[model samples]
Target chain A: MFKKTILLKDTSFSPEDKTRDVFTRCLDYLREKQLEQDIQVVRVADSGVYGQGLVMKVLPDATLYVNLKDEDVTRVIDAAAQNKTIEGLALKKAPKQIRIVLRNCGKIDPESLEEYIATGGYVGLKKALLELTPDKVIEEMKKAGLRGRGGAGYPTWMKWKFARQVVADQKFVICNADEGDPGAYMDRSVLEGDPHSVIEGLIIAAYAVGASKGYFYIRAEYPLAVERIQKAIDQANAAGLLGKNILGSAFSLDLEIRLGAGAFVCGEETALIASIEGRRGTPRPRPPYPSVKGLWDKPTVINNVETLSNVSFILLKGSEQFASIGTEKSKGTKVFAVTGKVKNSGLVEVPMGITLREIVYDIGGGTISGKAVKAVQTGGPSGGVIPVDALDTQVDYENLQKLGSIMGSGGMIVMDEEDCMVDIAKFYLGFCVDESCGKCAPCRIGGYQMLEVLKRVANGQAKLEDMTVLRRISQAMQKASLCGLGQTAANPVLSTMKYFESEYKQHIENKKCPAGKCSALSNYAIIQEKCKRCSLCQKNCPVEAIPGSREDGFTIVQEKCIKCGRCLEVCKFKAVSKT
Target chain B: MDKLTPEAIDRIFKQNRQQSANWIKVGMSTCGIAAGADEVYATLVEEIKKRNIQVTVKKCGCLGMCHAEPLVEVCVDGMPTVIYGRVNKEIAVKILDKHVNSKALLNDYIFDLETK
Candidate 1:
């Protein structure tokens, strides 16, 4: 067996990589000392930590040495050889990815009830059932300061407490697993990975609220998540962790699965309740809220999948420990589904108040195209774009809200220099318009008018006054919409307009798409200086847009050119220019 | 698989506190499956059984590094536990042949994370 494994990387900003240099030096020294056989040196791609120049991690020991100079290299090698840590050089990295909601994920076999239980899965429910009273469970939740992770960030304890205090014949609890955000899949992963944790949390919620029945409203699109959750529910029933007299306790809660017919609007609490009640999945105005009047007009509590997942974790690992992880207000970690232009797109669970710069740059490993990050879009279609300048701000409910984003279900899509803000706004606004339930006229008509105005703006057919019209529609939608869907649907348009006004102005005044993303506003042309007189563009155009011979140097027929971007794609000489 | 009471939960957790030795876990979540982790899992299981390898293969969930899907984490008796990312069927066989049986870590596929 190898005595030491030295993992080295030159994580410096300079052009030269010193990882190989250090590796050679360490290898030479080890060989000279006749200890090469005992130690193995390997160059690795990612060391999890970044920008800490010439980083070396001695594996098995995991002793990390950062900012290594030539002199410190020898000392680090010696320390690794002796299984010792050099004093000042070794940094005990506080773990970056804190797995709380995802604690059982990727570790235990999700299908195995035994595996989940072995990982201290339902102990939280056990604690809530046997030791703590309903009031005490609510108290513990209040102490934990946990909030709804389904974008709104409402206090979870408050929802449970309100549902608990209501004097109703029968109460209901619903787990909103109808996650429909375009790029977000955190809830699906949790449901698929550790369904027992969620089942336990939902059981705890049922017990705390004195509810006799519960439902898992999962989207039909997530067949795997549904299967895993169904399996987990079955396993829990067999183990007495779910259904009647759970774990031999007095609390008898029956759990069932409700499949969402792929409606994005059903993610809203009221719409989800309607879907569950076998009615049209549309939102009704809130006065009694879901806590007082929900599903069959019985007092009910609706918790998000991630929020319920956190419940079991918060209870299992004490409220105080959960409270200690994040910001003062937003306790515990929040999972974000980072996608789009990001190098490493995945679900990352991090403590609240962690900077967006750290999330995008450090955790995500920067943009995939290596382009300068233009802005990061958080909260999906219902959220807004955060300019690269504002990326340094900490991520929490309040902070993201202040940044004009709501942390909507933790879908963090990164945008680079090539992404046009106007186009992005139009794309998201279009999604909302398509998904609009039409129950409320404000969301239906207002979203359509706003999208039309955005379309005109993108096509360079709108005046600067259209911007005012867009803002007017946005304000009307936010104020008069029936539910959260209509209320926040204008967020993307408003946010992109707010942060990237100059890009929008360029389209209106200069009639130029700065990012060249709006094809209508920009036209492609073959540069005479760059063109190699090749008939490639002419041969590739479907409409036969180009009319000239290869020897005569072909040029695009402007009137015939359909702007299909085929010529640009077929051109290997980099001759095609979009202007 | 009897209905577990409070006592049984404690006993299971106590038993699991000490991790099982010589196991390979493949990420079998949707993201992993989309990237063909299921094939990797099947290959490992089939090959391990065929070769009569002592290592136990198990299916797990996504570890959040989506760019490197079909990830497999291997832990043997003496070697350091390492996660091999972007693994395919070939890599699965190679992992079994080199990493597990021979106890030598593979080159150019380790995606270790501590934190940023």
Candidate 2:
């Protein structure tokens, strides 16, 4: 049995890996010293550290040694064998991630209510029901500074307080699980991983607002999440946690799941309420907000999956603990579904004040293609793009909003150099255009027109005046749209145009796509000097754009090429070039 | 199975706190299942039964490391609890054979995430 383990990784950018070489050398040295059985040496895919030549982490201790040389293998093995540390080589590592929302994600059996309870799961609800009054519960939320995580950062306590103060016989709480962001899955993960937590949070919210009924507005697309939440509700009902007289307190609430038909606009509060009410899922103006008039004309409190998840923890651990984490205004950790061009793409829960750089590099392990990250797209279509130069900006409600991006639903998509800004803006704008309910003309018509202009820009057919037209239309849509969906639909275009206007200028003036992504603006050609005259490009071109024999080197016919990139992909000698 | 009172919740919490000393938890959420954690989980259970290993195999949810799905966390008496990622049937067998039986940690498979 080995007493200690050493995880080794060749973190060098070189294509050639040195982990095997170093592993063998360490094994041989340990075997020669008759300590092979005492120390275990292993090669890892990622050592959690990057760009350093070679990294060796000794565990149980987790002392990382970076830029290790071949001779240092003996010293590492020796240190492990003797249970000592090499002061000069040892490196201290601070944890870059904190898990509050995902606290019991991998720890307990989610299917078993007993396991969740054992891990202090429903204890928050128990405390809320037994000790705290409705006002006290709202007070705790206010002290915790918890905010809604459904793209909008409204204070959770204020939403509950408004619903509580309203003189209504019937009030409701809805857990917004209708996550429709392109790359965000934080809600789905939480609901699937720990359904009870969200349920507990919902129950806590229901209790705080004096509501007897609650609903989970989940998208039908997330079958797994829906199934898990259904099971959780059933379990809670069985355990007397859901239906009538919950925890033997007078505050009894019934919770049910409502499936959304995969409409993006239905994620809005008013639209969600409309969907639940069997009405057409379209948004109306908010003044008498959902807290005052919502869901069958009754006061309702809508909290996001992430927001409710924080409620249970805050009630259980006290407001101080929850408030202590994150920036002053934004308390507790925010879970982000970090995806798109990232190396370690997954769900990361970080404190609110953590920098985007730390989240992208330290936690995400940088981009997947080993290319520098160009920008990060946050808040889905409603949010904006944050350029790489501003990566040091702290992440919070105000900070992201100040950076022209809302903290929408916590979808942080890391984009590398190959991703064209104009193309990305067009993709998000197109999503909003397709999802527009057509109730409001600004979102219905404005989104379509903006997308049309973006298409023209992408196709390299737009004039310099078109940029001004795009901005003018975006402002009009932002100001005239009746609902949040239409109001924020232009955010992606506005943000991309703000940060990447030069790329748009390149597309408009030079008729060139800097990222080589927009096929409409791309031109493909055969580099005559590099071509081997092997007929490979000619044989592979589906359009027969490359026409010539092996003797007479192939040339690309530009009009027939279609810019499919098949020739570029099939070319062996790097003969095909795209501009 | 009745409506839990505050006292009952406390009792259940206390009773559940005393977890078994040796167990293996497989992440079984959508992300984990998509990455074939169900197969890995089945293999671990069957292999443990076939070998009559004194270890318990259970299912849990994703640990936020969706990239390293099919994560298998092993916790045995006198062994440091560690999560092995990208696990499959073969690795499950190796885990039971080498790590569980001989008390040796697998080298490259352990994913040491800083979740503190």
Candidate 3:
């Protein structure tokens, strides 16, 4: 086996990669020195660092050297062989992503309770029961300043404190794992990765609020998450953490898993409570909020999977410790599923006040296709678009709302130049319209009308005056809708119109899709100058829009073209053009 | 499975922490499993037992890097703890041979992120 290994990747913007050449030269130099058998050199797909010319990581020593020149290859090999340090070339990487909510994730065996306890998982719950009273638990949460991570940004302490104040024979706490956001799955990961953490958190919430029972309202779609949580509950019960006086105290609580039938509106508190009571999952207007009157008309507390996971962490690692990590207003970290055209798309937990630019470029490694980011869409359907210019703005609860977006469950979708704002807005609005419960007329009717206007806008049939109509319907839905679902459903439409209004105007005035995303307004044609008599586009077209021979050359029948852009993608010579 | 008292939590914590010193953790969450972590996990277990390697293979959750799934984090006696991403069955065998048996670290696959 090789003694030392050097992993190299040329992360430059140039299309022609020089990693192979550099790898070969390093091998040649090692062979010349007769050190080839001692040291191994390999080319990697991702060097984990981008835009830093040539990134080479020397293993065993774990010395990272970036921006290497062709001449520096011999010096790097020599330094590694001699076990000498290179000061100028070493890159010290500081981790941008932090994990508090995901502390035990990937660290411990999630299914093993013994392993979880070893990681100090249930110590928080033990402290909450033995040391602190219900009021004191809420006070500790208040010091932590953790807001509800399930979109609304309500203070977690305040919610529990309200439920604590209500005099009732019985109270309930629910872990809302019904993660229905289009591209968000932070909850499922946490549940599947560290089910015991969530269970411990839910038990602590029950203890803090003086609840005798709790439920895990996870969506049926996450079968693995459900299975793990069920096993965790069983383990907790067997360990006397649940179904009795927990940890040899008077605090007795039982936990159950309630699976949602994949209704998006069930994520709302009142709707969730109604679903738990075996009713049609629909939201009821607040003021007799769930904290005041919830499941079975008794007081209830519903903490999201992410929110509760943080509770146990906050208690274990003191509230002051959790309080010190993030900004003044939005304390602690937020787990964001960074998806869409992003390069390194995954679940990233970053402390509040970190800018979108840092999250996208530094942590996410920018877009996958390496195109200019047009906008970063946050908060999913209920959130809004943030223009590329405002990416520097610090991410907090209030900051994002000012941009017409709530930090809705932390789904950050990066959009490139090719993604039309109008089409994107329509897609989100279409999802909300489909998932709308239709109990209230404003959401049912207003959402339908606004989607119709957006469809008209995409089809190039909308007028400048139609903007007023869209706003009117949006206002109606936001005001007259019964719950959070309808109230914020029009956010995508409103925010896209606010930020990318010029792109929308291009659709109306120029009768063109700026990104060529709206198929109704875009057309595809083959350019003869670029065409190399390739008939691949003709055979690949699903609609048979391109009908021509290789020798005679082909023309796209515009009327028959579905504008799927298959020809644009399949064309090897770059013949197809979309306009 | 006696109901654990408050003291037993601490007892369990101490006992499990000292259970093993060297092991390989496979990310077995939905994302990792979907990326064929099951195969990577099975291969590691089979290779460790077949090769009589004095290390254990365990399952854990996703490490937030779903884009690079089938992530395997290894902790050996001499080498620093490192995560290897996008690992397949072939790479699994190579990790055992090179990183475990021969006492050399894998070059391209080590994703070392020092957390705060």
**TM-score of each candidate structure, all chains considered together:** 0.96, 0.97, 0.95
Which candidate leads the pack in DockQ? 1
Report i-RMS for every model. Answer: 1.9, 1.8, 3.0
lDDT of 3 by residue, A365-409 (tens): 888999999999999899999999999999999999999998999
Q: Pairs clashing in candidate 2?
A: none
Docking quality class, candidate 2: medium
In order of TM-score, best first, we have: 2, 1, 3
**Candidate 3 positional error at A530, Å:** 4.0
Model 3's number of clashes is: 0
Candidate 2 differs from the real structure by a C-alpha RMSD in angstroms, to one decimal, of 1.6
What C-alpha lDDT values do all the predictions have? 0.89, 0.89, 0.89
Query: How many residue pairs clash in each candidate at the backbone level?
Result: 1, 0, 0
Q: Candidate 2 residues A239-296, lDDT tens each?
A: 9998888878787898989999999989999999999999999888989899999998
DockQ of each: 0.70, 0.66, 0.56
lDDT accuracy of residue A40 in candidate 3: 78
Q: List the residue pairs that clash in candidate 1.
A: A96-B115
Ranking of all predicted structures according to DockQ, beginning with the best and ending with the worst: 1, 2, 3
Off by over 4 Å in 2: none
Q: Residues A283-316, candidate 1, lDDT per residue (tens digit)?
A: 9889879999999999999999999999998889
